[model samples]
Target: MQGWRSSMEDVHCTLLKLDDKAWSQWSYFSIFDGHNGLDTARKCAEDFHRYLLKSFNEMLKHGEPIDGPLKSSQLDLILFRKTIKQTYFFMDEQLRKSKTQHDESGAVVITCLIGPEVIYFMNVGDARAILVSKTGQVLLSTHDHKTSDPDEQHRIAEKGGSIWDNRVEGQLAMTRVLGDFSMDKDLVPPDADIKEYTIHDTNNPLGFIVLACDGIWDVMSNKECAKFIVERMSRTQDLCKICDEVLEECLKRGSADNMTIYIIKFL
Candidate 1:
C-alpha cells in the first residue's frame, strides 16, 4: 500500500482461510477506497467481512436446491451470487442507519470470495476485480461506475442529479458508491455488480485474481497488471513481493492517490 494523501484513505482485508471444513474451504479479499475522508473505508474494513461471513453461513445452512437438472457447479454459482448480493445490500442499509455522520464520507468497494469450486466477485463504484486465466487471458473484469458512462448518466439524470466535467454533481467522479450524504441517495446507489465463475479445470488452474482501487488502475490497464504478475510468477510465487512491485510501478507511473491492491493465485 502507498498513500499520496497526508492521511491514507484506502483499506483492505484478506482472509486466506475463511472456513476450513464447513464451507468447503474458501477465501475472501476486499478493497475499500475512500474519497474526502477515511471514515467510510475504515468502517467497511472493520465490518464488511463479518457481514459477508454471516451471509455465507446462512446460505450454507439453508441453501435452496438447484432448479431442474443444473450441474452442481451451476448451483454453487447461483447461491454465491445470492449471498453476496444480500450481503452488499445489508451492509449498505446498516451503514445508512448506523449514524447520520457516516454519510459525510464515501467509498468504492470491490470484494472477492474464492471457493474450492468457484470464484465470486462484487463491485461498487470505481474499484475493480480482475481475473487472469492460466493461459494468460483476461477472463473477467468489473466495470467502473463513472459518471461519463451512458447508463450511469441516465441513472443520475433520472434521480435529479447532474454531471459536470465527468463528475457527479461536479464533485465525485464515480456514479455509484457507499455513503456520501452530500449526493442524492437515489443517484448514488449502494447496489453492487456481482458475478461468479466456476473453476472447472483444476489441472490447468487460473493464473490469479487482482482486486484494486482506481489509484492503481488509473496508471495501468487490466492486461498490463496481469502481465506484470505473470512475468513475476515465472520466477517466484511470492504474492506479497509482486504486489509491492506493482505498487511501486504505479507510483513510478505517476499515480497521485491512495493505493490498495489484493492478489489471489490458484495452485
Candidate 2:
C-alpha cells in the first residue's frame, strides 16, 4: 500500500519454501522500506536472499543437516544469529560494489527466516515485527533502531556522529540500515539485530506474526494492530481483507507514508 507517497519505494519478499531438501521446510518473508530512492531497496529485494542463503550454506559443515547444530554450538538457533548478523555486512558490501554505489538511498529491513521449529527475525532501522501467541497475547517484538535511543546515541557519538532533531547525523532517522554508502560506516552501521523464538506446542501455538514498516507502526500500537488482525482473522479468515482494513485504518488515522504489512499465520 503506497498511501500518499509520491512514488512507491517499498518492496516485499515472500518465499513459502526454499528449494534445497534440507531447507525445504523453511520459509522466508521480508519487507524493505526504501528511502530517498528505490535503487537500494530494489537491489536488496532482487539478490539479498541469495546472499543470505549462500552465507548460511557456507557456514554449514559436512555433518550438520538443516536442523543440525553448528560446529561451535549444540543449539541450532545459536548458529542462525551469527549467520543473520554476518549476512547483513555481506549484503552491504554487495550494495557498495554495485552500479549504484553512490546512491544515498537506503532501506530499513524486517525479515524472517521461519523454520520448522523456530522463527528468527533479522531487523534493521525502524521496520518492526511482532509475534502473537494463540491466546491473543503479544509474545515478542523487534526494537526500532532510532537515533533517539540511548544506546544508539552513545554508539553514534563514539563514532563521531551526532543526532539532531532525533535524526542520525542530522539526516537519517535510524541509527542503523543498509545501502547508505554515503554515511560513515562506523556511525550508520548496516547491522541486522536478531530475535529468536521457538514455536509453541499444539496446546498453544502462535496465532500469527506481523511485519511492517513505520507507516503502519507510526499510527498503530502493537496491541492495536494485533487485536485488529486477530478479531478479523477469527471472524473471516481473510488475510487480504484484514490487510485492507488495516491500511484503511492507518490512512484514517493520518499515516501519510506508504504502508505495508505481512501476516504470517501459524494456526
Candidate 3:
C-alpha cells in the first residue's frame, strides 16, 4: 500500500517472504509509514528488503554465526536490528559523501517476520502493531513515539535540533526515522539505535496483526478495530475490507492525511 495526498509526499506498505532454502519454511509481512515525502518512503520500501538481505549476508561473512540454537524468530530480530543499523550507516555515509543536508524526508517501519515458532515483530516510530489472542484479548500493542520518550528528546538535542511549537510554549515530537538527515547527525552508534520488538509462539487459533498509520489510529481505538474485525469475520474475513472500513471511519472523524493499513491473520 502506497497512499499519498500530493505527488511529493507518500506513505508506503509492503509484504514479502523468505522461503527456507530447504523449501519447507518461510517468513512474511512489512509496512513503511512515509513522512515529509513519499520519495524516501518509496525508496526505503523498495530497498528495505534487499538491504536487509544484504546486511544479513554481510553479518554472516563477518563471522556472525547463522547456524545457532536460538529459534528463527529470535535470530530474525537480531538480524533485523543489525540490518537497520547497517542501513543507517550506509545512509549516513552515502549522505555525507554526497554532501547532502537539510533534506526533511523519512519513514517509520513495522513488520511481522513469521518464523518457525514465533512472530518476530518490530516497530520504529508512530505506526501501530497489534497482536490478538484466540480468546479475543489484545496480547500486545505498539505505543506511539511521542514527546513522552526521553531518548527521543536526548537524541534531538544531541543532533543540535529544534522542533516547532505552535502552542507558544509546548513542542513535542519523537526523534527517530529514516531520512531526516538534519537529525541523523546525532544518532551515534547508529546500529544500536534503531527500535525493534519480538513476539513468540503467536500461533493462536484466531490471532492476527493490524498495522496502520496515525491517520486511522487517530480516530479508532485498538479494541474498536479488533472488535470490528472479529465480529465482521463471521460473515466475511477480508482484512483489506477491515482496513478500508477503518480509513472511512477516520475520514468521518476528520482525518485529512493519507491513510494506509495492512492486516495479517494467523490461524
Candidate 2 stretches with Cα past 4 Å from truth are 62-76, 201-204
Candidate 1 weakest ten by summed lDDT: 66-75
Tell me the lDDT of candidate 1: 0.81
- Higher-scoring candidate on lDDT, 2 or 3: 2
TM-score for candidate 3: 0.75
Kindly report which residue pairs in candidate 1 clash with one another: none
Best by lDDT: 2
RMSD, each candidate, Å? 3.6, 2.5, 4.5
lDDT of 1 by residue, 15-67 (tens): 87775545435677889998777778888889998888788667755656433
Q: Write the per-residue lDDT of candidate 2 for residues 1-267, one digit (tens) a residue.
A: 889999999999888775455566678998999999998888888888888878767766633464632222333566668777888888888888884545789998999888877788889899999998766788889999997699999988888889998887778998888988778878888888898787845656789999999999999999999898988887888888898999999999999998889988885
Residue pairs in steric clash, candidate 3? Answer: 10-38, 85-191
Q: Could you arrange the candidates by lDDT from highest to lowest?
A: 2, 1, 3
Q: Tens-digit lDDT track for model 3 on 117-173? A: 556566655667777765556777876665556666565556665544511014224
Error of 1 at 234 (Å): 2.2
Candidate 2 or 3, higher TM-score? 2
